[model samples]
Target: MEIFELDKEQWKDFKLHFKWSSDKYYKVDIRKTQTGLMVELKLQTTDKPIVKDYEEPLWQQWMDEESDDEAQIFGVKIDSEIVGWMTVGMESWNNRLRVYELLVLEGYRRRGIGKLLLDKAKQIARQKNCRAIILETQTNNVNAIEFYKKQGFEFDGLDITAYHNDDVERNEVRIEMVCRNF
Candidate 1:
């Protein structure tokens, strides 16, 4: 397997292995999505809330994160097909970077692919002068939570009622983790 940069143009067919894992472990509604589920960060957030609001433009805020220095997008390719990916980016004014998306394809799990991607992100985070790293996943995703813990991350906070009518899978909870450069 190899890792390379990825752009939104390549996102059309490169969705993570979420559905397959969801089917076996959890379940998918196949109708609604929680794409609009923000981190419920705080009363004053700088992201511009491109996901839920309808003021300026729809995907403008999404694209805002794609800037070169602030973020790095990588696609894991194997056998001429894209199977996994990891995106690392920094949160402005926080001195902490994060692994935005870390995923491996369905039949590609348990083969160390996810670990490789995660390690790569950590390496990059340290190189970028990040005092720490942060990432989030659903509470029900026990596998991911465990994986993050094994990688030296610790529980930082929780966002209750993160998912409701916006997603068919209601009552979903979001948990946050932080890893110091120590």
Candidate 2:
């Protein structure tokens, strides 16, 4: 397998599609305290494996004009077939590199493809003098969370209502992970 940078045209034609299954998720719990609010995330097991499938264009059309973030796309290809890719962007306002997206095909997972892509993102961050590398994943995506943790990321913060008002109830709270050492 070979990893390389993808041009705009090539990225435009690239579609990110992947499926994931998880038997565990982080349960978000929030409570009001005298001083402030208290937040907790507990690892919980699901009765059955939660599966998710997604298929979408590399870049959202709405983000084209409104987004001021500068990004680059890199893909992993094997024998002319693209199996995984990552979109890393520079947030000038924050002076950090954000991983906008990262996906590896189901069959290509566990082969260091995701790590390779993330390593590339770190390299870019260092080259650009970024303060850190940050990305988001759902609490229900335990596998992804574990992967990020293994790569030296820690839970920096979380949004209880990022996707919807009942995101916590839905067990899909948005988790912001950061690798500051990068």
Candidate 3:
């Protein structure tokens, strides 16, 4: 039930979920034991490093995302295990403090881990005097859409083809989450 700042030492448990494309989805694993959660992936091959193509600089940047305290990232750990992660940052459109990427591991999902992460993020936002908590999710992630809705997030409307490329589509719908300070 405690949230800590993400560190490289926890990499053995955290991996990025990558969407190569709608039909060809794959999670690019970070196999190194140095920093950040090097999430164990079932799909990874034994002999090769986890990230083969988009490695190095991107890996460093991914690690950097864990701590932008002006915009912070927090990891939920129980019994020395990282169960979830969430972030609070500036929304690009309004320049308002927002909580964006939120994720709880697959097996850890539905155990209220996500709520714990969000609750911590909300406290952080209030401390920072943030306007609200905002997030963007793709239509394909129906479960997340529903979860956010139940958490009091309301549709601000949809963005047309917000993100799309030849290899992938970023047509994510944006939802706004307001955090009212008590």
Candidate 4:
């Protein structure tokens, strides 16, 4: 496996297919008071896994708004084919590295490709003097959550209404995860 920086043109041809079927999801419990808010998160798996294939309309819109020119994208090439990819950019305000995307092809899953990409992202973050590597994911993506946790990421926060008016109801609540460099 070879990991290297890829240009935007190369990224344009790269296709990402995210498919997940989980019998479980992270259930969030929120407590709010006059002072602040407290949240408790836990995973609940059922007898049957609920399967959902994420459509990327919202993500596409977000990508449209965000500048890709400033992003540093790395691709994992296996036998000259891109099997995994990750993108990281500096968040100037927070002095952190925001992971825009980290994906491996379905056939490449659970083969350490994602870890390689994550490791590369960390290396880049250190080189850029960032404090942490941050990314947002949906609560329904239990597999991804486990992967993030295995990669040393912890739940930072969550936005109950990040994508739409009924985000939590729709089970698409956005949860932020962070892997601190310092």
Candidate 5:
């Protein structure tokens, strides 16, 4: 497999679509405290597997056109077919590198493609003098969370309302994972 950087035009033409299933998810609970608030995330096993299918473009509609944030996209191709990709960008204000997206096709998973993409992200972070590498994933994405954890990332924060007002109840809370050492 060959991993190469994708130009803007190539990125525009690339479409990332994948499906993932999980039998466990994190249950989020927030409560008001005397001084502040207490937030708890508990791992829970679901009665049935939860599956999510997504299709998205490299450039999101919410991205600012005039902003200095420019994403660097990389892809892994096998036999001239794209099987995995990652998108990373520098967050100047936070002095950190943000992984916008990381996806590996279903049949191509478990072959270290994701790790290669992540290693490339780490390389970029080192070159940019980034303080850390951060990325977001849903609470229901247990596999992804485990993968990130194995890659030296820890839970940094979470957004209970990222997807909807009842994201926590829906088992889709947004979790922010960070790798500070690399």
Candidate 6:
């Protein structure tokens, strides 16, 4: 597989697909102590699998809203076909790189494409003198969580209401992960 900066002509043909199912989720517990607030993460498992998918693909919407000048997208190509892609942007105000999207085709997963994308993001961030690389993943995405951890990311924060009104009920809390060192 070859990794390259996404070309304009190659962007439209690549379909974005990120579908996942997991039986494990991180449960959040917040407590208040005299010094400060403490947040705990517990791994919880379910007998049945929990599936997650976009209501509609996000590529078109992202293309519409995010200008090419603002976001840098890297694509993994195999025989001229894009099998994986990652989008990242430098948040100047925060002095960090924000990873907006990272996805590999279902068949292309577990082959280091995601890691290559992340490595590209880190390289870009270092060039820009950013402090960290940040991204968000759902609590139910255990695979992604594990992968991020293996990639040297740590749990930075949590948003209990990041998604819909029933995010907590749906077991889809948004968990923020960050890699501070290159």
Quote each prediction's TM-score: 0.66, 0.93, 0.58, 0.85, 0.93, 0.87
Q: Stretches of candidate 1 above 4 Å error? A: 12-14, 20-63, 66-68, 165-171
How far residue 180's Cα lies from its native spot in candidate 5, in Å, is 0.8
Model 6 steric clash pairs: none
What's the residue-level lDDT of 30 in candidate 3?
31
lDDT of 3 by residue, 1-182 (tens): 67887644444344555321232112223356766556321222224222211211112334335434444557888788877776556543453556555777667788888888777766765675666666665444446666777776655534433554321232233334454441
Worst 10 residues of 4 by lDDT: 55-64
Task: Report the number of the highest-lDDT candidate.
Answer: 5
TM-score of 6: 0.87
Q: How big is the positional error of residue 176 in model 5, measured in Å on the Cα after superposition?
A: 0.7
- Please, what are the lDDT tens digits per residue for candidate 1 over residues 1-182? 88777764445344343542221212222334467443432212222221221112112234336434645667778889877777677775677777777777667877778777877777777777778888887655656766788878887876655656543243245778988843
Name model 6 segments beyond 4 Å from true. Answer: 8-15, 32-36, 55-69
Per-residue lDDT for 82-109 in model 5, tens only?
8998878888888988888899999999
Report the lDDT tens digits of candidate 6 across residue range 1-182.
Answer: 89998754556455566788899998777789999998878899988998877633324446435433477678899898888888777677678888888898888889999999999988988888889999999889999999999998999988888878777777788999999988
2 against 3, candidate with superior lDDT: 2
* Cα lDDT over the full model 1: 0.61
For residues 126-165, could you state the per-residue lDDT of candidate 2 as single tens digits? 9988899999999999999999999989999998889899
Candidate 1 vs candidate 5, lDDT winner: 5
Candidate 2 residue spans exceeding 4 A from truth? 61-69
lDDT score, candidate 1, position 108:
86
Best of the two (1, 4) by TM-score: 4
- TM-score (C-alpha, index-matched) for candidate 3: 0.58
Q: Which should have the higher lDDT, number 1 or number 2?
A: 2
